[model samples]
Target: MFINMASPERPVSNGKRDMEIDKYGFTGGDQYTFPGVPGELPAETVRKRETKWLVMLDNWNIWMAKRFPQLKKRCRKGIPSSLRGRAWQLLCGSRPLEAQSNQSFQDLVSSTIPETATEDIEKDLHRQFPFHEMFCQRGGAGQQDLRDVLHAYVAYNPKDGYCQGQAPVAAVLLMHMPAKDAFWCMTAILTYYISGYYSQGLEVIQVDGLIMQSLLRKVCPLAHKHMEKLNISPMLYCTEWFMCIFARTLPWPSVLRLWDMFFCEGVKVLFRCGLVLLRASLGNVASLPIIPDTYETMEKLRKLDKNDMHPEFLMHAIITLRITENDLENEHRLQMKITKKKGNSSVKLVKRVYRYAPTLQHHGIVQKTGATKHLSSVSVDSSQVAKQTQATLPQKDKLHNDAVTLTVYRPISQSSITTLSSSHTSNQQSEGPNKDFQLKNDVDQAKGTYL
Candidate 1:
């Protein structure tokens, strides 16, 4: 149902829906506002996405939780097929509001300047179940909806600009939702669910593979070991599953059903689902026995599309797979402990020994040493100085500070020289008494250990 935004002065459309609008009253990107309730069309006019099943390991969820006690209780149930889009939108917290709902997304999409729209959308556009009516229906309202949703997201987060994988997500959403509705879901998925993933630069999306590997290590150590032996991490096998949320890798219905769990649960669902796959294929992975090269391991795993991964069957496989509670808690606790330990270690190592490392030159360490008394003083640097003591310290330890120069300070006597110049001789004789006294004092200071 649509929320009615129109006041009495605003005219509602009385004719059938079409591509263009007669009234600028509801026109956007112009100097006007529309009068009418932005209501949802009746259910009769809406369409369903094309879907099929591949994996059917029945009772997979129950089996997984039972096998591994570490899994959290899913308070939220999976969304029904009919409401998957709405549920996903709700899950991502990206739904549109009445006053300003979807306006920014729509405005941004309309204004985006793409380098080449045809190749960008076309390359992966038809690849996603092109035979399906919902996605393949060219120039149809359905296609427009998918385009709007995808384009809006690309515009909203231009950094991730656009990628080939998003089509399947949008196409899948379109099959089950309106363009605007799917846009809301896309925002939620991109913002809250996979916020960093779809950016043009793909830095965050790439980072996720790293995080997934960490999770794998905890949940399935043995499986993780096998992957590491191959020197392959989640970067190798899991990127596509995440990129499309398993649209291409898993069957359509299987993905939709999985998404139901995903929206209700969040990303942990993806991890748990992945665990099921690893456990089910453990025998296959071990038998293949590949390792030490990430690409090689990946090549072996890519052949995992067994072509018969039905939902019920995977459900069955996961249910039977053995995962333990001790394993889950130990995994989570291990990561949490490591995180805390690293934070503490950094503070200790960077702690200041003196008031400032650079400001030490201004302190008493340099000014008090006797010139002849093994006179090496610590150069206090003040930059690393701490506020508590405000002390400047030398770079080396206390023992080395004074002993460095004592070994070279032996005084040599001036040899008796008979210069024939009488005037210069008198000048030298006058300065000799004061110079001798200074040298004697310096020598005495060194003998007395006055440093």
Candidate 2:
């Protein structure tokens, strides 16, 4: 007997099914949609760029050392999507950290983390790029990967634990690369580029917000006046923009482009982009009618027109703005001074802990433990150098213990080598057999010689 079984009708209401999905998997016809405009570079241009980028990747250390300006120019143009993951890793100096780390990503992910962080991460997994195919499905690979990366970060950096904003940033990174690479890139960013931003007090971000306001006052006085008149503090609007690194706020193409420059140039790109956004939204007289009050102003900021955010337009705007690193540094110093005068002890501690030095870690001078130490290239006085070398020697072979004075020879130029040799010979002859030690010639062509 055939049963009259009927399948339940699928509910339909919105135009979701008709929405266009872009090549990158973002759904169109809504706020989450990728821009419909042709914002990407031409195919030919992209191929050329990819070739150049591959060459740059091969000589990354050399390019970073000698041809930084050219490298910066290319990065500002945009990294090709295929190579972006590796480019970002190189730009932020994460690849070395990954190699140097004592604990692996798997180790961190398998280890236990705080229940609070785990719960928070679980809650936010589906929310990051929910419209995108990768993360759209519950318990999918994307969501699982996102969960693992965030969980590992909490285990890796217990001090910061996990911030809600980091999920989206990690989600973006995971979209480009594997969870392991994403974790290290996220570590470099959190450790150096925007340290203290996600710490308990959110103090560094607060200082940056103040810096943003000061920048706006100079770059777009009209916008600054409007915001100040309405008493719309930057923290009210910019916290999410800065915190998520604009992963949530900007169009996908613009986000990628901004990040390209950001990794190459450091956090100043963020400030420049923020200034551009503020000027676009609130600086114009025409914008005032649309964004009259704080609520409307915030709405405008949150839901910026995609056309304005298209990479070509947005990047052009960001580039035209003449803000410099010095400007950002000056503003940061000014804001911190004001904060210090206010006697906010907690904020003061934040300043001390997260003092802004964007390049400190990128050059490998700062370690994962948050300690600041000098690299081999840093110069030391002869006395200190002697003391260090003496400390390394065996106690029984210690010159200090024998009451014999030791001379530490500095690296000398090739032209001065002969003079130093002659002086050493004369000293040996004058001091007789007691000074018969042979001089070691270790020539470091770049810096000098060490004996």
Candidate-wise lDDT, in order: 0.42, 0.65
Q: What TM-score would each prediction reach against the true structure? A: 0.50, 0.74
Which residue runs of candidate 1 sit more than 4 Å off their true CA positions?
Answer: 1-78, 96-106, 116-119, 137-141, 283-286, 289-300, 305-308, 313-451
Measured with C-alpha atoms, the lDDT of residue 134 in candidate 1 is: 53
User: What C-alpha lDDT, on a 0 to 100 scale, does residue 217 get in candidate 2?
Assistant: 72
lDDT of 2 by residue, 203-305 (tens): 7776777778876877788988888878876777777877888876787778889999877666667888888888887878976987778789877887787
Worst 10 residues of 2 by lDDT: 422-431
**Could you tally the backbone clashes for each prediction?**
62, 1
lDDT for model 1 comes to 0.42
| Per-residue lDDT of model 1, residues 1-451, tens digit only | 1111111112234433322332321221211223342332233433322111101113222212122112112212223344455445433444322123436656856876576753576455545454454544466565666677777776666666777667777877777777777776766565544545555544443344444555455445676666666565454566667777776556444566677655533444565667666644543555545533655555545445453355656644543333322222233334334434445332111111110011111111222221121111111112221221122122332323332211111101112111211111000000011221121212222211000
| CA error at residue 235 for candidate 1, angstroms | 1.6
TM for candidate 2 is 0.74
Model 2 / residue 340 / CA error / Å: 2.9
